[model samples]
Target: MSRIPPIKITPIKLIIPAMFALTLFPVFYKIEAQDLKLPQCQDEEIVNTVVDFFISESVWSAYGESKIKEMINSSIHTANLTLKNSCVPMRRQSGKLYQVDMTIQAFDPDLASYRNQLLRVTEPTIIKEITQKPNHYYALVVDDLPDDILGKTDVYLDPQFLILSDQAEKYTLEHELGHLANAWHDDTSWNSSLSKYLEEYTPDAHKNELHAYARGYNCAGRRTIMSQSSVYYLQLPIYSSPDIFFGDETCGDHEHADNARQLREYARRLKDKMKNNV
Candidate 1:
């Protein structure tokens, strides 16, 4: 098994490589264009956001409401910081920032009163009933998720609703939010191009491809939060970006992926749509 590099940081020039390779991996990233009833992205210079999280009775019982709120808030803070570091134009040129405040409340009044258990749910109606706006997000924190799932997002929704398992890792919210921002996984092509690359180049590269995916390495082999989750975890709150480099490794345009750029585009598109609506 090839040794996984230890987490390290060495400053390098910020230069985001072009994503021409994205066209080759449309299966992993493209969504068909169609009319969507979900909330649209706003055309705003600044994003002042509030995310509401509903705590299930069972989860609240296991970990008090305060603890749950703290964890979620911390995750959001990390996400904001990652955006600040990875996407410079949001703060420097545009004077825009991604700041999200949070509210934690009881999941359901009836469920809270009787300590009723809420099952794992993916039904659109249930989420729609609770999701009030397309500009903001609503997350339902439940007691459990499948062994393989830490959290899941309703991608079809405009402002997505996230179903987070109580046992999810600290940065799981960040990873899910990346999905909401249209950021594809850094390791999304493991079965396709990545496997082929490994076969041609480093056939003995990694013993576990899933772990490799989860590492979400940029060209320099630094971990990015948006990669698929594996036993190897996100050591730093970083996203792959064309504008920032966390280390010394250099990569060609074809080898790069830029989640940070996608986030910037998401905000821009939302701002444009909001302007048209106005």
Candidate 2:
């Protein structure tokens, strides 16, 4: 098995390679109430999440079971830490500390053939087949993802499935999870503005030089983890708070995506469902 490059300490800009292949198209389905019960956190300030990950044959061959397990644990840890500090309800808004308690399980199946089907066809045919259980959120860890698409969330179809590339950055998994929690991208509507800012403020000589997207600091930089991976070099693992504008004090008072609020609201809905046995 050919080895993939180790994850960088600072994630690089996302670029899609034609040779690499993975397909996840938009589709919708009625979500069935999961048979697998989420742990109750109704009176408490926590979201009990269970992540079931399917390891592709390529990943299994490259990293083996032990290393794959380590990667999953590390990803979950990063998610937990990010939510703890960045979530407004958890950290700043309320005195109570709201958080997500996440656990992961690894599954090994004939995913090589399944992936081949995806490349050959458009329909997500075999996802339900290999899922060993119901209710727990599911993910497929493939060797590579195409189209600059590091991850894809199945929020509309089942709201329980995600497709992730093993080659993506460390926080890619968390980014997808944020989507599951109803978080939106922080870079929305800033594409043209960012491009213009870079062209105007960035010196022509230094324009080619790579830089992070910080807004107030140097008229360029990122405050939220939901920003595109291309602008992620200097960003901390934090979400946009709903109570404040995305650009903060220095930048314009444009409305941010408010990922923190979305996550908290999603958690609240989940807790209520659990409490009501819905």
By TM-score, who's the top model here?
Answer: 1
Q: Candidate 1, which ten residues in sequence have the lowest lDDT sum?
A: 16-25
Put down candidate 1 lDDT per residue, 1-278, tens digits, no spaces: 44322222121221100010110110122222221111222343664344546565567667864576567756676666555655512321111111111122334332222111222222334335434433456555665444555666534323445666666665666667666664556555545754564455332532232122222444433345665534433244556644344444421122346565566666666556546654
Worst 10 residues of 2 by lDDT: 92-101
Candidate 2 structure quality by residue, lDDT tens digits, 63-106? 86567666666666666656664442331110111011111121
Q: Which ranges of candidate 1 are over 4 A from the true structure?
A: 1-44, 88-132, 157-159, 188-216, 219-221, 229-234, 250-256, 276-278
lDDT of 2: 0.45
TM-score of every candidate? 0.56, 0.54
lDDT of each: 0.45, 0.45
Q: Quantify how close model 1 is to the true structure by its C-alpha RMSD in Å.
A: 17.1
